[model samples]
Target: DTVSYGRIFKADKQTRIASVGIGYADGVPRALSNRLIVKINNKKYHQIGRICMDQLMIEINDENPIAIGDEVILIDPNESKDLTLEDWAKLTNTITDEIICQFTTRLKRIEI
Candidate 1:
C-alpha cells in the first residue's frame, strides 16, 4: 500500500480504533499496508497505516462494543461476517494459496 492509503487518519465517535498485535513479520503483506480489512465482533473495519513488523491498526465502530483482548477475525470462512483469505489475496493481488503459505510460526491457528 502507498503512503496515501493512510495519509489522513481520523476516527469519529462512532469508530473505535484498534492496534492489532500482528504484522508483516507474521506474514501480513506490506502490500496490504493500509488497504486491508479485519473483522471484529462480526463487523468489518478498515486497516489503517503502513503494516508494521509487529502490528497494524483497525478502525472499528464504537457501536460494535470492542475491548482489549477481544478475539479479532483475520481470515475466516464466515463469508457473511469475517474477512476471508480471499479478501487479503485480492488486496495483495495474490492467490489464496500463496497467502496461506505466507503465514509464519508467530501466529497460532485456532478454529472456532
Candidate 2:
C-alpha cells in the first residue's frame, strides 16, 4: 500500500505503520523522505514514502509495543550516528546550520 504522497511503499505482508506528527513544515526536509531513520522506544525504523506537509510514516512490526504519544527521535545523537544533524545535513546536501534553521518555531526544543 502507498504510505505517503509521492512514493509507493508496498509491504510484502501485513505491517504496522505509525504516523509521526512532524514533517517538512515542522523543519523536516522533504529531501529526507524515505531516507530518514527514526527512533522510537529505543528501536530504529526507516521512514517510508514521501513526507507530507505535517507528517510522515514509519513501518513497524506487529509485536512492537509502540503506543500513541511515545517520543520519536528524528535527530538523536545518543541513539545512532545516522540520526545526527551532520548526517542529515549530508543527506540533504546542506550544512548543519541550514538543517537547524529549517526547524520551525512550531517544534518544541527539548535539550537533553
Give per-residue CA lDDT, model 2, range 9-82, as digits (tens).
77778888999999999999999988999988888899988889999999888577999999998888775477
Q: Which candidate ranks first by TM-score, i.e. highest?
A: 2
Q: Give per-model TM-scores.
A: 0.77, 0.90
What candidate 2 gets wrong by more than 4 Å, as runs, is 110-112
lDDT of 1 at 31: 86
What TM-score should be assigned to candidate 1?
0.77
Tens digits of per-residue lDDT, candidate 1, 1-112, equal 2222355454444545688998888998988876777777777788877787888888665566888998877777858433778778887888989988889999987798
RMSD of each: 4.1, 1.7
Clashes of 2: 0
